[model samples]
Target: MDENESRISALTLGGAQERPMNEKLYMLTLSFSIEGFIRQVLTQKNWEKAYNKHDNSLRLTIKLDIKNNGRIIESIKLIRKAIFFWTRNPKIDHRIWIMIVKDDTPFYPLEEEEARQLLFDFNRDIEIKPEALKKGKNNIAVFVELSWGKHEFIEKNTLKKESNIQQIEKD
Candidate 1:
């Protein structure tokens, strides 16, 4: 080994591919060496930062316009009943449940906290039966009741302010 050369600990790569009819696939790839990965991991304190970021980047986009007093939308239909679920948080209050509706059919309600966590947490996995999916736009609705207190909605300015009381004393 040359005096200037260092040992290689790891290697990483990222790529994507796309193709059209009778056309060659388009591809892009990027590789990272151990030093760079180690630098990022040490600075961020997260070893899986790169993997997590890439995995969570893909998404399905949908937009819904809500009408006043519209409680339910009945345009989507599901052909299957079985589904799988997971959420960002590993543990949540399982007693409360939330409803997930597809057209007139409703899948079994997921735990209240599980639904909330899944909606916000991108790292988790959720799978619905393939037969339940439609070719294009599909209408689905979620009905949930989340009770919040004053503390839950604290303003950012309030969080930045220093506490007025410097110290506490017990009488």
Candidate 2:
């Protein structure tokens, strides 16, 4: 076999398809925040840096950006500690919901059904809007309502900001 043929075989040996040099992988960045009843859960150090008590409800904002690809979602998981913080108070009954909005119309194939499926696969109980799915560059916003109590607070801390990027490649 020629050098070029051997190189091609090597690339495909692991079930990896050869992509164009110009083609880049997609990246999704999710920025999350926690607010509301934080004092009950956060440590003294984290509380002072990441605690915000001025908002009416416990809010978690997840800003995600997909790059070089057009996949809706991979997975979703809730932080039990954060949920516990908001639910500890017996006097407060919070109804939490998630709102997902597309900042830019996503590329084709990333439609409402895909988005719905992503959410459903993650958690069947959570509620999501069908209209939230739209075609755009690759920007999506996810708002997670942690709690809805009378108290108000806003927390901004480096530790509270959770971000993740997932790259999906088709064989």
Candidate 3:
């Protein structure tokens, strides 16, 4: 696999913000691919086929642990079964946003659909992936973390604004 594909296979996202009741709201978006990590429970045999939501039985568990000052503050584990199969439908992209609350609650999907036609424009092709006869989009994984605490004071700020003339000159 290439560098971008490798990154998309595993990643993490986290953030925290102030909320009512003196509580902090933390949001995390985790994305991963389990293309080759499946085995049979009885025979211990590796699965060798495209994952089908109708036939395949898979379980995913996500655990989040919050720590403060080298000690465990709060933790949560979410277990979910696969419902939508994205690999089979590569024409559509998917994204899931999980909101972690004090109580364990599951969310549902909203249904809406539309269609439109578009013109195609040919452009210069940039070689970013391995040469292959694949027809789909590239996967991207990004991790973000947000924290809350006493704001740190900076003595000398180096940030400055520059005009277009200055930018052109520097370039």
lDDT of each: 0.24, 0.27, 0.23
Worst 10 residues of 2 by lDDT: 4-13
Candidate 3 lDDT, tens digit per residue, 75-101? Answer: 445444322233333433333211112
Error of 1 at 16 (Å): 2.3
Candidate 1 lDDT by residue in tens digits, 65-128: 2111233322221121112223333343332223333233554433433332232221211122
Candidate 1 has what TM-score?
Answer: 0.18
Which candidate tops TM-score?
A: 3
lDDT of 3: 0.23
Error of 2 at 17 (Å): 20
TM-scores of all candidate predictions against the true structure:
0.18, 0.22, 0.28
Candidate 2 lDDT, tens digit per residue, 1-171?
Answer: 322110101000011123334553332323332222333232222322333432322333332222223344433434221211222334323322112222222221123333332222222222222233334433333322232232222234322222232223332
TM-score of 2: 0.22
Q: Candidate 2 — which residues are off by over 4 angstroms?
A: 1-25, 40-75, 82-136, 147-171
